[model samples]
Target: MLLRQLEYLVALARERHFARAAEACHVSQPALSEGLRKLEDELKVLLVRRGRAYEGLTPEGERIVRRAQRLLADRDALREEATALRTGLSGTLRIGSVPTASGAVSLLTDPFCAAHPLASVQLRTDLRAEEVLRRVRDFEIDAGITYTPDSTEGVRTHPLYEERYVLLTGASEEPAAHPNVTRPNATRPNATWAEAAELPLCLLEPGMQGRRTLDEVFTGLGLAPRPRVETDSVASLFAHVRTGRWASVVPYAWLHVFGVPPGMRALPLVGPVHGAPIVLVLADRRPGPVMARALLEVARRTDAATVLERLP
Candidate 1:
């Protein structure tokens, strides 16, 4: 069967609509339908569940779609290999990163681009830890930056750094001269988890690894924190904390990389000291992709101490 037919099949499975899939493949609906029909005839098995509207793929069709995805990924890998042999290593490197590690991703990407000037890099920062691993396994992303837990099997991980948590809040300004005035100590050097939980706080959503770690720590300490606001974006958390009325627990490196916004202050978390080991993950394929290998080289040479020191 033609590779084009396989492309049409995969697109149809993804879109789950005949017209949308045709649009995605840049072909007419009738042409796409004819292509799939021809493919089924060649294979001697019905691929699509035909109806007035678009019915789902048949059981065999589902199996073929999975195989087709792998075939397309292998084709792309072959093309990348050919290009590398002709010139130097050059192609788009897709990286998925968890929200807390998003700011620190530049530490790896910056040096990687400098070493391979012709290579392009795409960084997806809002992925959850599970999503990052899922994308890597599915060939959707070349690598990812996420927390290094104990369950990484069939995946290679490179430890980058340990992320320490901190409390972010607005900077306390001096109160004007008045007979009755009280100012809170917003610039405290450190705060306990219990203390931070008492404030109206904004935090990352529960699905995120960063938020999960914080939740576990709080739970272990016999504290239950009900956040005033929950969001998926770390930038949004910072925005809320900047209002002086809200606070959040975030990574120390986040404050260093993004800087304390004009009226914000970052305080170290006290009491139960905790940190998560951030790592770079790639599928454990024999002779992995050239771009992923190049990124691993950069990670190997990166000095975690130096990276932390360079942070603002």
Candidate 2:
């Protein structure tokens, strides 16, 4: 019934193990379990499925957990509203961002923190589009940096910028590298998504939104890329490409943050596959006073033009 109980429940759901969840909440396992029991008793519903080990939440338990998450979010918003009214501003802001956009995460945080030095920021780099929406709805994260499939409901988006896919290859003229091509920009040995798909490629894991988009583009062209390697980290992807044998598809903006190695050249994916837009998404629900204003300020500064100009 109390917000603290709901907080414990959320942590438990995230961690899946009672002891670890309790540790995260800075409480003993017994205390955390007792709180959850009391919450179930108050609501008159079973909120957890207990066995020899933690199994999972019951159907009703799952429902309650979702509601509890929203309730806690509302509570935090109320407190933020009151505090902002009393003082100028001060509170924690949690941000979730897709792995690709993780590079640009600081673009919003740096300025926001500079203006409101008292506020704290919690950043989560490993996020999917659906996960971002769920956290934002539950008030877990204040906002997110994600790409568009525009599938998530109950969220508003602010366009950050469009991203063009680029090929990354090593510096040396290794024969192992794909043969050089004469495009408008032929100084670099590069190919379009269709062209690259013909050769061995390194790509992100399939589930990631970035990979999905790349796949869609490749599939649309009736081409299936043969990946020599796959991974979750952009750094690792570039590192592999730097070796000269592998090449990867990356957003142009990424080249700016993780600079292309001296031996590497980034050629834009042209011909059939152009690019896609990235966005900053936030919950449609009102935020706490301090966080609400801060969220708007972030959205204001991260407009399409600002981000586009920074793209490689």
Say which candidate scores most in TM-score. Answer: 2
TM per model? 0.87, 0.88
Can you write out model 1's per-residue Cα lDDT over 1-312, one digit (the tens) per residue?
479999999899878999999999999999999999999998899989999988999999999987887778778878888898899879899999999999888889999999988899999999999989877866778999999856777578999999888888777745412223323376456778887777677899988889999999999999997886899998898888776677789888786577778887777788977888899999777688788889999999987646774654
Candidate 1: list runs displaced more than 4 Å.
Answer: 50-55, 149-154, 173-188, 309-312
> What lDDT tens digits, residue by residue, belong to model 2 across residues 197-289?
765578998998889989998888898877878888877888888776777788777865877677777877777657678787777765433
Q: How many backbone clashes does candidate 1 have?
A: 0
Candidate 1 C-alpha error for residue 283, in Å: 2.6
Pairs of residues at least 3 apart in sequence or in different chains that clash in candidate 2:
171-263
Candidate 1 lDDT score relative to the true structure:
0.84
